[model samples]
Target: MPSLTDSHTFSLPSSCSFLISVTDTNPISLAALRSTHFYLLGEGSNSIFVDDFEGVVVQNKIKGLESDDLNDVIMLRVGAGENWHDLITTCLKNHWYGMENLALIPGSVGAAPIQNIGAYGLEVSTFIESVEFIELETGAKHKIKSNECRFGYRDSIFKNDLAGKVLITHVNFVLPKSNYMETSYGELANLNAPTPEKIFNTVIGIRRKKLPDPRQWGNAGSFFKNPIIDKSLLTQIQHEYPDIPFFCISKTLVKVPAAWLIDKLGFKGKVLGGVQCHPHQPLVLVNIGSATGKDVLEFARLIMSRVKEKFNIELEPEVRLIGRNGLIEL
Candidate 1:
């Protein structure tokens, strides 16, 4: 483990660089981070950096996972840098049931709120009871309630106002009590999954088979956030596309499959330089060997532009583009 004083920076995906400084697990380190010359603090996982970074990048390395039974619900208090998938399996092994559907989504536990990471029939926000953060200005750790989180589809206040400040220290989750679960995701629909363990293994299996691991491939899963369309507009989309898969989230907002849009628009498996859209799931952008941040940024922009022209509705990226280099805000 690197000591609190040591901070380093390295080139990743080219054209993108973050000045890594601070390994502070102690209160003093966090206080120092609050006053860091560079305000941006990021944890484990890759975020495509923008062009220039004038701020320091800090990664939260606090570690712990503990649970308490609250009669009807079990709450899990997980550390920020906890390996996400490992945490999923750990929940299953302990007989916790709500998070099984969310297995294999990349990034860390701290990021789950920022993206509201979800799959199958589960979203992290629904399970999130609260989040604790070291406020950037105050350097004081304060717990924020779920409603105050300002969560939306693949978005939260963390991405907006707290964009470069608060470092998540702990996340609290409320999980299901009994056997009730949801495995009705398109891939899981036909398969009969009777038990929690079976569901956990099956979900992990599906993710492994469909999505390339970021560890080996150097890619983030599902580069685009599935567009949420109004029901009337969704009807128009369905009529035009017909075969597109969708799920209803509210009376007006329906979640549309980004993979279907990318594949249908013919961007799937298309490679431009070292970057390529994943063959199996078009929404996933891959870094083949040493693709630079510029390559991925341009490809994603092209995809968004194409999707917008084809569908008349713009698609948005789920990943964050730090600095200001690699982003198409349309």
Candidate 2:
């Protein structure tokens, strides 16, 4: 039984009876988990375990990469357990374009689809061909096409109907040979004709400045989803605070930065016990040294309540909270 104290980014106190790593060619590990209540853990980048898990915790370590050239596009079938950033780096090394804007994101490939990871005007779903998984109950293998994944802003079927019901084994991606870089988000917009490497480096630099290194500071990247609001509501808010920053998602929808909302409430660097709303980025909550899961959750609630009181909009967490009972939604 391996200890999982350091397994999650939040460093929340937790324990499990068994910790197993499943690989690409092996279906037996997943089969053994059929009769047990289990939770699948990836790189622990987005997990905030509130309490000790009772049964089993499985980490996907499947590794392999298969590629095929198809005219203007190249397809890759990557093992679910592979590091997400490493995959992006490999693509860049091989001259494969796409995924440049998603650099520096933490977590394994298997966890990418669960959250439909996106950044800099590009989303993982844009290049995803399909995802392969094995049913938890029967160990039956299946491949779901990208169109059927029900991808939305930081959400997917894996987070809903299929949550904890299957183990992702592989993810297929289709990348183009030519440059199709995205540099329209925030600071990247200032770049002049960015290449894959340029876009990758730029995104990495921006993220490093905004987020804390998990190994040292302890954080799970962005804590809240950017709130999408109706255009009318956005207009109403903008009328009150003309300087409120927003992104036009559509004619009827707009995205308001949750960080801005938190910052508005004077939460930047606010501390509750051992947790602090990172001084530089209010969007990230970090453990200063002795924070417990309860402390983090409580601190998050304070931030949420203040945001709701001020903006009348509820902020949702991007990090999955796992307690002894199962997934905890805040």
Candidate 3:
């Protein structure tokens, strides 16, 4: 058995029967591994192993970044295993404009589409042209256009219909050369004459201030998705707490910050065993030290129960929790 604590950001104590790192897309080799239980992993920023896995853990290390410069747009084919924040840094260095708003987000390029990773009012789905992947069962290669991915707020087909059935090989992105800054969200709105480089630096600064460094404190950023609720419910909550912050999604739907709700309930810096809810950003749950999977599950459940009882909104976990067999719902 091999220790998995160092593999994932949460740093929970666990091990797997086998740990394999795939640097290339070898269909035959991957297909053969399908005979046993296995979990696909990238940089392991968004996943936490809650217990000793009964089977193999396949780490995706497939790396490459190829670019095609079209006069108005730059087309990039990024390997699934490539670090996401590093890609954003490279884009900024090359004067690629659109991804600047998404700087400092952890995880791999492959995981980006699954979550439709977003920040500062910009989403990765906006620039994604298509996704290339290999079917684990049949060992056949396939490509799907971005529109067909069913991208939603913190969701996509990779997380639902195609999850656990395929392994991402590369992500195709098309970034326009034209300068269009997204300064509508939070601190970005305060930037004076913001450029891509400026936006990148600002976003990084905001995240650093709000989010804890995973190296110093074990954490998966934004443990829960901001719960989307009906306008009627938002009105009711607002009546009770006039300043309950929310983002209007549509005429009927609104996204209420999970952090606000948790913080209101006095869960900020709350601890259960060795796990603690982050004080600065209540959306994050951190492993203070020597935290076990049981502690994380219990602490999360407590928060979920309290939020539901008070707000009548169900909070869904953004982080994937892996148990002995596979992903478990909170």
Candidate 4:
């Protein structure tokens, strides 16, 4: 077994039987795949490996880009192995409009659909046309339209019924040829006149100021998902804390920022062993040198317990935790 300490942003100590990097999708065979059970590993941005994995880890590296321009839309078929930030930069350079709000998301393209990655006021699901994946169990290729992806806040079909059964190979996005901008988020709400470059630059600037660069401070960006609660519950909380901010997801539901709740609980800058709740962004947990996976988990539990006790809301981790057996749900 080999230690995968550097593979994850958490810098957690873990191992696997073997690690294979698949560059291109050509010539894939079941005989080679079925010899050992495996887990698809992306850029390791959204994972926290709590323990050594006993099975193999497949690093998806498939890469390329193809475009078909229509009357008002450009359909882009992107290789899953490509860096997400690189894709956004390319789209901006080519005058693509839809991906500006999602700039600087740290992960590979293959992992985007799995988590339905999003930022600011836009989600990948909004621009996705379709997805192409290879079924690992049978070595069969399949395509599913974006509408069938079952997308939700930081969720998709890949995390549910199709989990561990397939590996995404490509994602096709339908981007607009003209003006279509999203700046509903508070930071971008006041932009005078936003272009693809302007929105992309704004998002990058905000993220840089808020999130610590993973290179300098090891962290999985936004450790917890924003909790969506019933509108009735939001009203109840609002009575006590009138300034509580939230976004209306539907008539019956409201999404509240987990960072606000954690900050309210006073966990920012708090440390447990080598792990600390980020000083600025309470939702992010950082490894302050010499932190182990267990250390990070303990710190997370502390935050969750306090938030639950105070707000009666359970915070769910956005980062996927990989254990010795398989995916571990906290």
Q: Which candidate is the best by lDDT?
A: 3
TM-score between model 4 and native:
0.97
Worst 10 residues of 3 by lDDT: 26-35
Question: Candidate 2's residue-wise lDDT over 13-33, tens digit each?
Answer: 678888877766456766778
The runs of at least 3 residues in candidate 2 whose Cα sits more than 4 Å from the true structure, single-residue gaps closed, are none
lDDT of 1 by residue, 40-156 (tens): 434434365534544455665667899998888898999887777888888888878778888877667887887778888777898899998877677677899999899977778
Candidate 4 has an lDDT of 0.88
Per-candidate TM vs. native?
0.87, 0.97, 0.99, 0.97
Model 3, span 234-287: residue lDDT tens: 999988899988898999998888999999999999899999999899999999
Residue 286 shift from truth in candidate 2, angstroms: 0.5
lDDT of 3 at 225: 92
Among all windows of ten consecutive residues in candidate 1, which has the lowest summed lDDT?
Answer: 1-10
Query: Candidate 4 lDDT, tens digit per residue, 66-135?
Result: 9898999999999999999999999888877788888999999989988999998888999999999988
- After TM-score superposition, the amount by which residue 224's alpha carbon in candidate 4 deviates from its true location, in angstroms, is 0.6
Clash number for model 2? Answer: 0
Note the residue pairs that clash in candidate 3: none
lDDT of each: 0.72, 0.88, 0.93, 0.88
